[model samples]
Target: MPHSGPSASGDVTGAGKLDRDVLKVAAVVVLGSIMAILDTTVVNVALQELTVRFQTSFATIQWVSTGYMLALAAVIPVTGWASDRFGTKRLYLVALSVFLLGSVLAGLSWNIETLIGFRVLQGLGGGMLMPAGMTLLTRAAGPQRVGQVMALLGVPMLLGPIGGPILGGWLVDTVSWRWIFFINVPIGLVALVATTVFLPQDEPERADRFDFPGMLMLSPGLALLLYGVANVPGAGGVSRPEVWLPAGLGAVLVAGFVLRATRIPNPLIDLGLFRDRTFSVAVLAMAFFSVSFFGVMLLFPSYFLLVRGESALSAGLLMAPQGIGAMLTMPVAGKLADRIGPGRVILPGIVAIAAGLALFAGVGAGTAYWQLLAALFVVGLGVGAAMMPIMVAALRTLRHREVARASTATNIIQQMSGAIGSAVMSIILAGVLAAKFGVPTSQGQLAAGAALADPATHDAAAAAAADSFGTAFTWGLVFMVVSAVPAALLLRKAPLRDELVPDVVDVPVGKTVV
Candidate 1:
């Protein structure tokens, strides 16, 4: 059913009339968005600390991060339904409360297993918060202001990823690793209160039965697939039974979901949305960029600390420049996107990212620190500029009723792609290390350790690791270059203003974009 309002393009009340209310609601929603995004990378800086504190193997400790990602992937498909069944405001508050509770428990965990469980809990809440927040923001702003709202929301979303490691590293060095989780408490509390008080409650529409079967098929399928992919490289490739079983099962289940969705009236994902050429292309571009961007972001901190011998705090500080570069350029990019077209802005941004990654690929063990900073800054600028445009273009043609579903789809794709990207990078890096240095089998382990105990051997191993990282960065550049092609070709060339303002339609159920 459509909403009861003037046509999406009609001026029921001028923009100024509800500007304050929209801004206030946006503030609350952006806060939740930031918290959700921060959790994605917050634990990255603490991985070394967690490994030491738990006295666990590196592979075991990796689950702390991987599990959260899998849980996030599992929960995202349900957001559109959840928001409809329970009102958006109600669901937002609940998600925030659950997130806060999970954070508190995570901080108090007794062991690695407990911490991983709590992280999953946090991811569950976080997965909902992101899509829900975008749903609310897009609805509140209407089609006219989608770009503006997205631009505002993007600040925290971009900042969170860039800032998480920096903040986490600072807390771990100065305070304790627990503080990384604890920091979300105050922010979540403020967002919860503001949401309850400020957010408008739209009347609920009657809906078809919830798609439980689709959920069963899609959720576990993605979770298991991601789990298998994440474990493959670490398990010494796909030849292992452990890798193939889950991956094969996941593939079959996903195929099952596609078959089931076709038979259902209202599938959980509304896969029909992909029928639109622009929407399909936008989603593809978003996913491709996410794979390359996230893959590189996940690699950086480890490279700094493990390869460069930088302390966690220093590494975080070095990473800060990227955020600074992004912050400096985002507003200008957003305005330019509004004036010209997202495609024009985004294409250049993609090229800049490719250039930055190419520069990073040249870094050696003895490279100057300034060169590293310069490369990161360029990448940050590119990401900051490109992201808003991609989002704006994706939602450009969506009707108000489908906006939530569209946003949810975009969020899920990005998350899944990021997870896959991280796993791919991890495998590539690990494989390079193993192939170059030889596997640490029984005899090899003894010899490698003996060599490492001597300064001469340690230096050789360190050089090999550094060289492997440079090679990984080269691969990363290749990924970015390949991703840029589709983005340039598929994105529409129309100006943002023309895209935002749709023709007025007179439909009975509220005026929606036609």
Candidate 2:
């Protein structure tokens, strides 16, 4: 890295307040980061509407979400290398620009096929944002301040769930679903300007050999794996030609990549980073948590819209409590992780989230909205406590040079697990509905949607639909419980100083770049 070292002050005043320059960098990152964060949540709210508008089956409509995530998974392996070659600031700007272009194209899309294709374009850009932003924030704040800064940025990343739904719901309700994509234009322009004015400049970090083998192996492997997972329901099982052929081949290729990564010096994701116990455990915990957490996020809006017979806006509004819960806990968790090891903070968060999921698993059509909101609020608190701190723990222990790679690895883990969760949960919900109603999942969903539209059949359909969602939520609950095992394995210790190596000067921001 251009900057990597330890400072004496880092150890002595490890928990010191953030200075102005650091705040400015944080501000720049937050501004750019919000767009990507908001996009996912807002789209989650819109999925129900997208299904109807395109006149597609639920399985096909899912590609709009899954394809974007797979695109993120595919591009992420290159980011650590790209950031070093191109610099985070430059890469961030370019990513934002690409995302804006994708947004415009997506808004103009005529059908589900076109929308899914354009969302892949959106993923190509969104994939780079969090990892690049993480590299920037981690470098700027150094080790001692990592927790607080991560906590700070987590606000939008977390709060966007709340604001995104309200905003998306309103736009989708009153305006057009196209506006959800169009909305990014002005926000992105402002982010581009803020990045130019506020983010500091740095020369290309000393470049390393591009891990072309790792790229070839990992990218295709992830894409195939996720593709297989997404089609599992329609294919009957992994035993079918469509599922087994790709899923089996994908598993083998991914295994090969992991094996080779251990042998190569500068592998695409740097498997050796796992030598640090804190980094390894936190990542493990996060992977499991994300599989559960993101799965729940996907299923939540669908339950409200499908089972409850609510509008997009109503569904979005109903989910706001989870964001409200997250807003309350994230900062405190960040601070606690900095003081004590992440293990303590993360454990409690896992427990809280599990509790919330348990409530959701037992939900019935007649369950009170207030009880559900309370559960969402509890889930929010757990998310605030767990998600960012897990990354903070992984990064805090790594050297500054390794920070970029580490960020890239964690983001890949997150996106892949999230995609898996979405696929798995959707498959589960469809299977449950099919079993309960004795129809194919797509036919089941389409018929249910039609039945839900009519007042005559709505009440009769509600109970069965809610029960299917509850079964899927129960499956998600199991993953949440599994995630806690890793958090429990995390070690506790006082914060250590991560010194900035001498030559890593904070180049002034006045030196701007296109």
Per-candidate TM-scores read 0.83, 0.85
Compared to the true structure, candidate 2 yields what TM-score?
Answer: 0.85
Find the candidate with the highest lDDT and give its number: 2
Q: Mind giving the per-residue lDDT tens digits that candidate 2 earns over 82-157?
A: 7778788898888888888889999999988789889889988987877678777766776566667767767787
Residue 63, candidate 1: Cα error in Å is 4.5
Give the per-residue lDDT of model 1 (tens digit) for 391-483. Answer: 766776665556556665676667677766765665566556556667631122223334445676777866766676677788788877776
- Computed on alpha carbons, the lDDT of every model, listed in order, comes to 0.71, 0.78
What stretches of model 1 exceed 4 Å from their correct place? 1-14, 17-27, 54-63, 134-154, 193-205, 338-340, 395-404, 435-458, 491-514
At residue 318, give the lDDT of candidate 1: 82
